[model samples]
Target: MRSSNLLKRAHSHNKQTLSSLLHSRGTSPHPQPDTISGHKLIEEETNPNYKPEHWYPARIGEVLNHRYELLVKLGYGMTATVWLAKNIHADGQSGNRKYVTIKINVNTLGEDFQKGRRAIAEKLFSANPQHPGYAHVRFMLDTFRATTKYGDHLCIVYDVLREPIDLCMKKFPGSRFSCGKLRVLLPALLKGLDYMHSECHVVHTDLKPDNIMMGLGDPNLLDHFVQHEHDHPSPRKAPDSHGRIIYTSCSDFGESPTEAVIASAKITDIGLAAWGDEKNTKPIQSNVFMAPEVILQAGWSYPADIWNLGVMLWDLVENIGLFDSISTEPDHYRPEQHLGLMIALLGPPPKEFLARCAKAKWYFDADGQFKYPKYVAEDCKFEHSIHRMNAEEKDLFIDMAKKMLTWVPEERWTAKQLLEHPFLTKERECYWDTPSLSRASTASVGSLIPSRQGTPGLGPTSVPNGSIHHSSLPVRLLELVPSLASSDATEPRLQRQSTNGSLKASENDEKSTSSSTLPLKPKMETLAESKGESNDETLHKKRSVSVNKSNESSQAMIDAILNRGKNHAPKAPAK
Candidate 1:
């Protein structure tokens, strides 16, 4: 798959280069696609095939509302384009100019625009200033209609913000933020989520990386984002034709002055957020961040936000997507595969939760295996447990992931509940010492070590003999020493020899196992040899006893261990 993608990209690159050369010499390589004429509605914005008219020919120094001047385009989304503009009336204060972000809705009469306007207006009018999340939420300053050459575009003004958290992730790559930084950012996000759910009675249906923007305090990073007037389909310069900048009215497309601001983290873009009581069967959330309840058409509320938050945190920390929805096959079913991934990483959904799901049969059977195996082929390659952290930290995070991503929406932890979890609270770092019975009765997260046992198992949830099992080795050690159990069927058997000097493998199997066993290397023997100084006598006796035991089978592993004795200087045979 990777090679195929590289080949295709190489072909495209060569083709583009050839085309560029031809175009430079007054020859047409390929005809351009036709552009469509329209009022630039939602269909135009969404359809890749359509080329809608620009809502704003936003140029430098364009003044709006007799005060705000459009300086640069910060970003754009489905229904709106946000621009960084300066306040002409406000004087500079605190070493920063009073800059604002104006979000102009593409079509004022569009349904999305009206709905968003109503939602924001309602929240602002009734919003509690004392709410804890208020500081984290983007502050909406004003709203008005900007009459352009095309039509009146609805515009909402806000204090200028830095880049979104996604940009921050891209900037820092692996370390999205240090643990110290996370301690600050995550708590603020949780506080915001708690306040929105409990006090504002709102559900932020779309809370992906793009929605969570940075606060203004960081370096100015908007120059590259701004679209120059020459780059626009039509530059609304004065009729002088020399293209000198000019401002006609509060309605005209003209240049705006600029200002600088720094960045931090804040929750923005509440266009899709809904009242808590609103009921609908429509889909919400970015595909990769979609909760199981949203996919199953089961009802959802605050907990759904918690699920998104958890996944986002994973992406921020790990620098990789926790749940990838990209389909390998063109015909692959997404929901089935997404659910399969959830099950593979966590565990099976509760039967009662499955009973409530309308499409449960399509995804899971009575025994919890995926019904459509082909659709979820991607999940087949995933390990049952997260293989990234130490046993303790791995246990801690998986427990948190499980709590946020439960099959039952009701069973998932709320933002407030999660904020109190030991993973988030510094004071409760040692809380794992107290065995809190897991929400899932089957097993606690610490027990589920990723193992070679064909099926990854919760390691000795209960020891029958009250003695430690071989599997009880620290997960770190298990990682270093590959488990024999997960190897090919014909591989040599590996079992602990009895302390009474009996060999673990039977004699009949000895011949068949030798060729299958890995070759012994000097470096591999160092681990076994480090335990004792009188190593030669101990090694010689073990080899002799293993060969003498009729019950013993393949001595490949024992031979590998004993071979280390040969690598040592023929130390004077102990008298």
Candidate 2:
């Protein structure tokens, strides 16, 4: 009878509207003894690390703090168990009651450690709400202590979110995100980083796929999950010798609508984050994604996060780690082996860079050469590793990665500068038609003069002019004139000449390309005429050329723009 009733409930659940499913006004049904079974195995129960004394035995329908009622276990990690819970005390219609995620940490962590972690999150998330990147970071809503027979557990509350990015990647073929998906996800993540670094002054030392989470793109996912769980209670194991029952976690949120796309992402887990002013020698970041400075104990800061993100991004796109040589064995990772892999891909670290590193002597000799030269894999080059991209796309992606993966911390591009990278902004250029360009030229030219103040997190506002940086203008100009790009088809697209060097665009052969002799007026008139612009509008638009430069002159300007970074390369800061 119970089995038949559960089947009927599930069938009825499938036909209910999302609103009716989630906002149903009634007390949730209690888990019945007939529904509990000891046959199904729970993964956490089988783990050797499972300790009954350390974990809080939270049961379904149990209310914590007299407010939140536990609905179902979402996941469990080494240190915590997460659950979906309802705010019974929230003032709303029964069907419209608020729901939240409760992360209950292991009692072994102690109250102080959990409180400290909560403090850091509260300080950073509330630092600057007006910043654009604020929305991309997961904010902590509340925290409290729950006392039980086992020990005191610290419970942290947050708004409900979808699963982590690592799990999301498994849904895609080859376990990789397409460049199109990256275009959407990466910017959202970068915005979060910009907020953490620029506005909050917090550095997220750990930034692997697990730390980044996908947002709830579909509103019905949570509703469906709740209804499904209510209909069919999760199977549970019988009591152990210590009388602890382990329940199977229900993590599936159901298949998304075919048209739904993951349009938002948020950076979570700031427990490892450090303030910019608190630069220390303590090691940070995951093993494979560790920045050179961090591995060497060379006093890292914001740039470490950039390097971390760059490697993680590569892992997302290529479905493998860039530094794959690092051992995964617990407590057996060798820094020298990781450094060798870095050398194989990024060439040798600059002697000046190695000089400041406290641990560099262990890896490099007095001459600044790798002590274990044979460990360097000669075949592991950056360009050869990238697959499935055309020459232009590959070049742009490499350019963006190189800016972040530099050995010198000062050389790495800041989060704001990377936002304007050609790889990221390529889609925006498609909207620039003839009339759009004619109107936007003045404003775009004005953007060339980097703003020193006004908006935050837009560009370099504090750095001096001679600092090592990539200019977005040259790429913007090339994007504006597609004819000029086509005119010099033979010219090499933007490519990295060396691992340690600045990126350079091609200087077309002087005599062969029409760009050398092309006049601005004829091109503008042709563009206007092609767009069916009246002669009078074309004349009026011609006067809008704020900078009195011909196409030939603009070509010269682009060359200057490409070479400017080399001339302004910044010196390493004093240790």
Candidate 3:
């Protein structure tokens, strides 16, 4: 007992010492006034490595231009660390203090590549000012370059998002998305893709569940939190190197903080986005999600993205990959197996598709039969495949998938064309017919919300007041093939020129690749948590932690989040 008490006292003393060191660095726990504008003070000049700092502007507690304060690390990937930051310019606008996602580009691209990235990203932004406001696309608010010790860092600011679609699937009772929710989400994805392809002239080569994000938090409260920042003045807080909090944003909500809702879905991570006209020589897209023509070294374009979206849709609703993503034989190439699975499920490719494929001989004979016919029929089918959806729904889904997954790239429907397909538009009014449907769907998952404890053990449930029937999520091909699941699926897309620099591989064939790899579930943090209110170990260790500080609205948000999960729980599998 005496030793335990001594240990507690020692921990307390050490924490206090750390606090004192932090306080000594500034007058108040907040950022020093001069640095608030994101400017380097004269004292910083004494550090001979000031220029080097510019190479890496993403340090914890680092203030930029004295305006944006890096608070919590929302996430990090190969090339960037996404920080949740507060704009501290004291612009006297309430919105200045609201949360923003700042993506700081690592010095991973060569000078030429970096220039190309910057130009393309800017073109995308300038092409359509209203594109960010689209329901499906992640909105970019600002962009700038900062010099650091490592090199010049390219930074882009965007609105904060909740979690990706994969988590939404896992959070549900049986790890599946409800049909109605899928109905709402898939179309939103199509609309965003259409807008990007037609309007922005961009092709998001990497389209997968990891890239689709669901919005959380009350839009009204978040809006109010930012818009009224001058009036409310959220106290500023910063986390230490160990992710310990030394300050806090003192923003206050009167009595009722509005509850958070699942907003409309959006497409994110346009890092590998290329213009439709540009013919990229390098191989692109993740392997499992790659289009057939891409593997054959045949030219690819927008239709490839459509194929990716179709596969992504299957993964989203069914909780399983449409393709095997694994190899069956040592000598037989994996891409051939990928095509074989397609044939086993959708039938043989057309002569036109076979003609276009330069390497068709590798997988198919002159007569269009798979070189190894047995691999096609027997190996692809799994025990937990999608066998439960009613015949009508299954037919509709297959119809759409077949249309998009055409062997001939040109035969696939354009984004705009897919939007018009009966599958996407039949059940509900189209995005063009009723603009308000987009807004309505954001807050529409009311009764469908689940409790906070965890997903319910119950089986499939209806999508609250909707016609579509939810089903038990099928196990993915990768899950069935343990070896394939463990393989680095995205690596082939890029041939690492240097461990630090980014390079696209012409030979590797992942359908989508990015500078960053996503976590199974992204950690969602609130404004309070961002301000160093919690410690690092606690935040990182907890898979899903809600903001539990004495804020009722935060508590309400947690309840709603959990409740949302319970509402989507699936039924038990049949005997």
Candidate 4:
């Protein structure tokens, strides 16, 4: 009944109630035990009260704006909690207060949940540098951890959205909005979506009505998001009949929002959002909103969200889902039936795709189902007749949806491209004006630590550790030897010549000292006026190729002296 809070109460799950079926006692249909059982349905993420040791607690709510005090324990789940209370004070002013929503520790929902949510939030913020419209998305107020009575708690504060989209659609029919409103809303959705794709590198896998909510307005077209970091942009106030700032927000990330919500889209319900490198939040099930590729058990890509967009658009543009899974026969889930939906709309799966699928034995029939003339499943032709609108509107919406719903993932239109399409072009400039898809966005990175390098789709795989990488050899050697002009080992050659010159100079000095008895002028002049035989320039220029030991190291020079066995090179007895 209360749509906004009902769907937003994702972390607070109610245990199942016992109906009349449980009334079995002695005279009743079935016997009952003393222990009572109520529906506390749980899967991987059950509402956990378990506190592993060393996992301590800390208070999240601290110095606030003088009035509001966060009374703990509104609700909690596997990952986080929702706190409810009335704000009584203000930080800068001795002021009055109101109630709001505070969601905490959103990351522990799982690695994927944390990664995807932060990925998009960062993406949106980065995409539109100065837009206040995106400010409403629940993001970190500030982060700090401390010990308390419970355990570890990660926290965030948020504006509590009082109403959700399903209730909006229920309360106000198609008459509530018009072509004008859709023009603005569609591009907004695209801007948000484009930020997620190019900037965040994430996909909102689940989309439905309940996730969105009307923002701070009397409920008209002027809606936008708010978060701690986003300074609610100076309002461009367009008044509804009651004259209020039309503000709206997609409430949760539990699932991806459908594209049709360009008119009434709300992003909420993030419990099933993609986690880790994959959408490992929950097990796959038979859901109508899933793309055909998911149905075929093929891996999901970022484009999988586009198929969801097409389906959502189909629901809004026409009053029906393009592929209604609820009505699907059990057998329609198989490849041929899966293929049937595409044929009915996009026409047969491209022949190239069939050829590819043919090689994938697990997806096809083993006994030649494709070759049989009697094969109804394989050969059945699909009727793609459109009776809804005149040829133009039908062709336009259908063609656009097809681009968003392509079979091959690479061919699918990204949110940025979709926002730029004719369906949304009326407001394309408005969407691109703020332009939320930026290259510098950090969506492409998961963690700054060097260790997070390769783990599936987070980015590309890393090269092995042992790669020789010989290209760096010269560069590295140059770091050690600043003057090496070629592959010839210049330092070794120079040292070798220095040793030989020194030894020869010593001999000449001894011979000339005979001048102490003879003349020392000849040797002293020779030393000053003439370059020795090993001119440094001549040695460097020579295209010499040899591993001369004496040239290679001082150790070789020591060996030469040892061969002479020291004894001072047999100095000519004091002349």
* Per-residue lDDT of 93 in model 1: 51
Q: Ten-residue segment with the worst summed lDDT in candidate 3?
A: 1-10
lDDT of 1 by residue, 235-330 (tens): 122322322222111111111111111123567766667666455456677677778878876666656777788777666655457765556343
For candidate 4, give the lDDT of residue 99: 44
lDDT of 2 at 105: 74
Q: Could you estimate the TM-score for every candidate?
A: 0.58, 0.70, 0.56, 0.45
Could you arrange the candidates by lDDT from highest to lowest? 2, 3, 1, 4
Which lDDT tens digits does candidate 3 get at residues 396-466?
45555655776666445455444434344333221122222222222122111111111111111111112
* Candidate 4 structure lDDT: 0.36
Structure candidate 2, residue pairs in collision:
23-95
Model 4: ten consecutive residues of lowest lDDT: 511-520
Residue 157 in candidate 1, Cα distance off native in Å: 1.0
What are the runs in model 4 whose C-alpha is more than 4 Å off? 1-99, 104-155, 174-181, 218-286, 317-319, 325-339, 351-360, 365-392, 426-575
Q: What is the C-alpha lDDT of each candidate?
A: 0.48, 0.62, 0.49, 0.36
Ranking by TM-score: 2, 1, 3, 4
Q: To one decimal, what is the Cα RMSD in angstroms of model 1 from the true structure?
A: 20.6
Name the weakest run of 10 consecutive residues (lDDT summed) in model 1.
451-460
Tens digits of lDDT, candidate 2, 1-106: 0000000111111223233433433444764422344554354444446687777878889899898999877776666778889898875444423778888877
| Higher-scoring candidate on TM-score, 2 or 3 | 2
* lDDT winner between candidates 1 and 4: 1
How well is each residue in 95-141 modelled by candidate 4, as lDDT tens digits? 11244555545323455555655655555446554432243233333
